[model samples]
Target: MRYAGIAWTDAGYRVEVLDGAGRRVVEPSSWGAAQVSELIAWLVELAQEHPLAAVLDSTNGLLDGPMTAAGLAVCRADPWLLPPRPRFGSVPAHRLAEQALRTPGELARVTAEGGTLTGRAEEYFEGVRRSEPIQAALTAAGRCFEHGRRDTPQVALTFDDGPDPVYTRRILETLDRYGVRATFFCVGHHVAALPDEVRRIVAAGHEVGNHSWSHPFLPDLTPDQLREQIDRTGEAVARVTGEAPTWFRPPYGALTPEVLATLEGHPTTMTMWDVDSRDWSRPGPERIAATVLESAGPGSVVLLHEGAGDRGQTVRALPTIIEGLLERGLEPVTVGELSAAPSDRTESSRQPAPAERP
Candidate 1:
């Protein structure tokens, strides 16, 4: 039997294979994200040559679906459990392979299960209900507003769809470097999956908002479903962060008449954005930085993302965005802080959520 470890890299992944005797079976090779299919094909061929099992760091959860779907016996090893190598920053692919070969029980087998985001959310809620008290539905929902006061010199950098094991920490480091406090509107299951990351966000003085339970289109959900989505997410976040999120941003800035009516009394502030980085679109770093820099001004809420996919470009562009905002004399603050300014500010400069999509 052979063990193969795949470590995530900005380029894609680095693969290392080891034989039963702890000798290198194959020289480490790197694969770009675009070449995942080829990587899988190579792994399949390797498996055909000898019985093989693949190990990936838990942060590389995104690769689990594809690798498992291709019939690779994939397993996840927690990076936190790896013994520290003082000078070496991150766990290397070779170390992961060595660990798998030495202690196979430490790895969790990855299977073709938990098919959809919605399914994962339901599963998470079931576990929570069994162990934790369900939180009450929010008592009142504030009017949804995009930007804060134009007269205030504060702007907000808000991330959506996160608690990602990797990118969220990277983004946090960038925010820390600049002493900036931002808001993270997290997906429910993501929060449940990585509560420690969510706690870290709060510990670092960043605000957290509810993005949704499953990131579904609110307009399509019945009133009960919508409430469950919001409530479940609220409970999941509160379970870890110690407080229910005080703000909610509908997935995709999607708010229709029925959705709004249903949320009328739900306590979370419906926060939207004025300047959109569109980082979720995976635009190049320059484009992302330019979009935020060119449009953001006083009281603008800039939309960015830390999770839901490869957010490398967003992470790369963040420093430039922070410096650019500082140069413009705008203070990057939490949404709660930014929104608390002058409620009388007009909406002329704010970007309204688009009309419900057909």
Candidate 2:
């Protein structure tokens, strides 16, 4: 196996390939961004002899489409996880190669397993995942709480990218059967397409949250774009439900300084989750149930998705998850009901905004 690290600056990109033994196989080379085709051709030729895993900084997400299209396995190495680089130097491309070769679990992938960060990478992402905007916004005013009050015996099961005609309705039925209320973070466009579905969520007494307009990576949007995404979704949800959302969860948990600043004074609690079910992967009903039951406890904000894909697995796991939480004497409730300070949510802790790897 070969590990190829691709790093870029405003000027261009640099590529370095190394074997398992840490010996350079492909000498370090630089390529202009426009030379992506040439770069892909070079990598394709090399891959004929050795299986190559192309590792890139999260900032170089633009290259993911081209690299993966060329049949190279693509992995992301986040700058937040790397050791501080020299002020005048970029993160060493060779270091990325070594990390990919060492504990590959630390890196997220565009293709392969391992949903949440594992091993040392987990700790690094957890420590640095909070966007600058979250910190600044919370420092000045309101709070960004991942979980509610730990002392409470309540847990919040929050769903993102939802109001789907199929899964959302099924999830609502399951919740209705269980007599439980959860939060749904919905996208704007989805709301418009399925206003009745979103209305059902509110009519059933579940909390609705703004999940951006089209669910794009929040950090990538310009300030105006960010505001529009938020406002549009908020308005759409309010239009359908006859009530504006009081909570906001950035899509993919991706937030930026601009996002926080723009949302500052928006009168919505910036809600995140402490426990990620990783149900998006549709691991299995049992696996999903166990994942939630294992980490979920008092005041836990559990992440689940009801829309944007075939969520039959998540729907299957719903009953077991609810039963397990009940058996443990923890009541599942909405984010608003679980958090004592929902109106003035305040916390400085955050997880790094993970790259949108598909």
* Candidate maximizing TM-score: 2
Per-residue CA lDDT of candidate 1, range 177-221, in tens? 999999999977577667899999989988899987656545545
> What's model 1's lDDT at 104?
90
**347 in model 2: Cα distance from truth in Å?**
25
lDDT of 2 by residue, 1-358 (tens): 8989877543446889999888999689987644656788898888989888888754343355446656777787765667654322246678788889887887777742332221234443443465554664583454676776777788999988777777898899999998999999987756876788888997898889888765554554456666776787788888887777878887667555556676675667687888999877667999999999999989999999876555788999999999999999999988876765533332211433122100
Q: Give the TM-score of candidate 1.
A: 0.59
Q: Candidate 2: what lDDT?
A: 0.73
TM-score of every candidate: 0.59, 0.61
What TM-score does model 2 achieve against the real structure? 0.61
Worst 10 residues of 1 by lDDT: 132-141
Q: Each prediction's Cα lDDT score?
A: 0.73, 0.73
